[model samples]
Target: MRISRRLRPRSLRTRLVLIATVLATSAVLVCQAAGLTVMRSWLTDQIDERLTDFRPPSPVYRDVADGNGLDHRARTDDVLPSDYRVFFYGANGRLLSESLGRSDGEPRLPHTAAALKLWNGRPTTVPAETGDGSWRVVADSGSDGMRAVVALPLDTVEGATSKLLWFSLAIGTVVAAAVMVLGSVAVRLGLRPLNRVEDTARRITHGELALSVTETSPDTEVGRLGIAFNTMLDQLRAALHRKDAFERRLRRFMADAGHELRTPLTSIQGFSELLLQQPAMAPLQRNEAHELIARNADRMSRLVDDLLMLAQIGDTPAIRRELVDLLSLAADGVTATALRHPDRDIRLVPLADEDTTPGELDVVEALGDPHQLAQVIGNLLANACTHTPSDTRIEVRVGTVRTGPRAGGTDRAGRTSAAGPMTPGIPASVIEVADDGPGLAADDAHQVFERFYRACHTGAVEAQPGSGLGLAIASTIAEAHGGRLELDTGTGEGCTFRLLVPETTAPKGHTR
Candidate 1:
């Protein structure tokens, strides 16, 4: 195990090549072993055939000739070769004629007891080793009480097998080397996409999210991974963009809050200082200074209250939801605003034809926090009253919008439609407060709902003093109730603020 670990390659490509080479070598060795076994078996079979075909001289020749007869010598010479040896023995196991002349090193074959016992002309073959080399021998006995044995040397088979083994080793070595080289190249090419992914990851770590991997085929593993990675990068970039936008809004809010607070604080401080330095000033001046200081103090208090309310709204504000009558709420808002500015012309127009009377109750109901919803309406009314002139007409239209209008149309009072058609999914109760005073410019209309944002009326009449958080608060409240507040206004057409809230039916026996 330790040696294997030491030999293991560090790189994946090298490891793949090493594994391929090992498998190939093992296959080659198996095939070579099979071939060698077959070759050895065939060579042994040829030797056995030669041994089976061997014959001895007839016993009749022995009666007419001596031990060194010409016929016996001729028979032995015909059957034996230089590398083959033949021996003859009598039935009693006595010495007889033998081939393998003494001048040829006189190599003898080992006697096999089992083969020697064979008789009846049936030959038996056996393997034996002698001083010269290994050999295959066949022994048989004739009816004349003579036994003959023939042997063939096995050096040729052994030599051929040895040469084949060397040849296979050389071939296997060359093939293994080639596989290693080619396999490494293939692995490197296959893993090239992964390398690209690593490079992209490195760049992303340095905050370069713009870099993306190019996918070659969606079906491949590497291509799918690249696609998923690109999707993740897109999501991360979007999140970062949202964070940046939120940061900008936060900075702006801080600057605006500071500026708004500074105004009231400066006024309060100046007035208080004037009163302190001039203790014996005129009675009228002293009274005026006290009143101014009190007014600035109130302004500062209201500013702080608005800021705190905005902070609360920024959090998840707990809402006490109940069925609310939007039409009744609008009427209350208009009455309250009229009481504040008695000379301002404020009219309440109910879009619901059934809600014709001013005292109609629960004509348009919705589910929300009654108090917050009322506050939303009151803020819109107050904003309209404050921005418009005393004689400029202001209209409060309360209605349940089931479907949108087909085309633009004017109301009985010639006011354009402020709220468009209701959104498709949910029924909504819309309240629009439109004023005929100088409308907000295009830029101001967009920013009117921003915290502490006041429009700059260039070369026009001054707007009423305000903390500029009313519309922002109203918009937040609307959103909390799964609704939205929108604006419809152009430069010369006057401004309209529309609040749409999802409508809900009142429960049985519920009264407002």
Candidate 2:
């Protein structure tokens, strides 16, 4: 086991080459063994046939011999080859005459009458009593009470078989070598792409995030693996980028929050210090200082509240979801804004073909946190009123719009919006707060929904003071409700803020 483990290939290419070599060698060996067996059998049969061709002369020729008994040596001249041996016996099982072949070593033939009779003249293999080797022998009895045996040695067959075996070994060795070399080349070429992938991984490990696998063919296993590996790398890179961006945003948000809070805190502290240091000041002066302090404190409180609302909206399950009447929400927002800024002409534009009668509740509905939705609408209206002039006309249009099949749209900045398209043929509730006022510049409009983003130009004479978090809060709330707040504005072209949310139906047996 230890030896085998040590011998096992460590590399894939080596293993593949070794396997191919082993298979090729085994096949060659099997063929060689089978062929050797067949050839050996054929050679042995040829020797046996030659042994059977020996026809001994009858004993009648022995009486006319020059009294040399049976002239057994003459039998080799006509029918027997130099390698054949002949043995003779009398009817009484007595040894008579024996004749040796031309070969130097003498053959061990059957000496007893019973042994000779057992042969029955059929060709067969028998071990030589001389301990030299084996032979193919035939024995038979003649009509004149004479018994004769013929034999031949098997040295030629064995010599030829040995040479053939050596040849087969040489052939098998060459074939195995060829297979190993070619198989190694093929395996190396096949694994080149994987090597590149490994190199890519190494580079990536060292912080090269942009590197990707180049072999992306879908037809081969290696190609498919490369493609999947590239996909995973892409996802990893994207996730890392998102993490970095989030960290940047978080740092900016922290800085902005600290700056926003510091202004009000400083004002409050300065005013309180003034009042405490000058207790003898006039009543009117004292009252004004107290009011300034209270106003800054209130501003700080509102900022904190907006921050908390953003945090809550970020938590997916924290927002309550219920049926909401968008048109009513828009109408209420318009009414409230008009009261706040009577100079600005604010009005809610009803959906086309819809009744505008007083107390009419039928309108486009959506599923969301009604309170949050109301806050979103109120924020939009307040933003419009704050940014626009007194004479600017603010129109709140509430209705349902048909959406496309594929759900996705980019914001003004080409960033993915908080909401995607609704189901095909389905309608989404929309509220557009459009104002004929000084609109924002293109650059400012892109980041208008960002936290603490204050536009310097409203196309109006002057931009109003704001915490700059209202629209950000509104956008977050819209996202929590699976909706989006979109802005369309240009310099001097007026500004339009559209709120789109998926439409929903009320539960059965439920009434608004």
Candidate closest to the true structure, highest lDDT: 2
> Candidate 1's residue-wise lDDT over 5-32, tens digit each?
9886798777778889999988998899
Whole-structure CA lDDT of model 2: 0.74
So what's the TM-score on candidate 2? 0.79
Residue 220 miss distance in model 2 (angstroms):
4.5
- Model 2 per-residue lDDT tens digits across residues 404-448: 422222333432233443345455677778888878776777788
Which residue ranges in model 2 land beyond 4 Å of their true spot? 1-7, 51-78, 85-133, 136-151, 178-197, 219-222, 269-290, 353-362, 404-425, 459-464, 506-512
Clashes of each: 1, 2
Give per-model TM-scores.
0.72, 0.79
Per-residue error for 297 in candidate 1, Å, reads 3.3
TM-score of 1: 0.72
Worst 10 residues of 2 by lDDT: 405-414
